[model samples]
Target: MPSPRNWREIPARYRLEAARCRGCGKVVYPARRACPACRGQEFEKTMLSWKGKVVTSTVVQVAPTEFQMEAPYAVAIVETPEGARLMTQVVDCDPGAVQPGMEVALVFRLIRREGHGGILCYGFKAVPAA
Candidate 1:
């Protein structure tokens, strides 16, 4: 079964929706209730551009129980053109190939299956930008 929190984040996960603080022009991903930069309470909904650059990355050699089969994957903090950064797995390439400053594009993909019932979860993954 999908967690209630995951259900609530569908808008950000599926559409790359972000909140832009009107006061400071700060763009925050996953749509926060308040702006962290300027403590602004008002925001405007904005859609992030699919393309971004890897700000940092790490290769996960040891995986959690759910992701053991996919061990040695690369996870990275990607920054979109709108300046919103989000952590996501880098896919469709060698784990070591992911590097800082590497360009990437967000793509919808199967994230994982939840629980014994195997409820499928979908989310975006970063792939090398064409």
Candidate 2:
């Protein structure tokens, strides 16, 4: 259920694809043409690990219209083993239970339905690591 502009991002969204800067070794999510840290143009495609730890978390009591049904969910910045941090919703547990330093695993799940037609959108969510 992604927008037309987001259709091109399916690879990164579904597979955790990232671009690593050859000059600075910085990893940028969703891929990029240039490195934000070093301003370097040379990059290599990399895949992020599914395992990570929550660097920060927040409970969302209010959400966008598209996600109204899922209000009061936990959202967090999860840092992967490679040091790539990405924002994702924390699911499959109590929202208030999410905390910084909590171990989590990236999971593929439904994000939301787009528009009135109910086009389904799939992406990654974080769950408490077993």
Off by over 4 Å in 1: none
lDDT of 1 at 52: 99
Worst 10 residues of 2 by lDDT: 1-10
Query: Which residue pairs of candidate 1 clash?
Result: none
Can you write out model 2's per-residue Cα lDDT over 1-130, one digit (the tens) per residue?
4488668878888999988999999988867787888999999999999989999999999998877889899999999987888999999899999999999999999887777788888889999999
lDDT of each: 0.94, 0.90
lDDT of 2 at 112: 79
Candidate 2 regions with alpha-carbon error over 4 angstroms = none
| Cα-based lDDT at residue 21, candidate 2 | 90
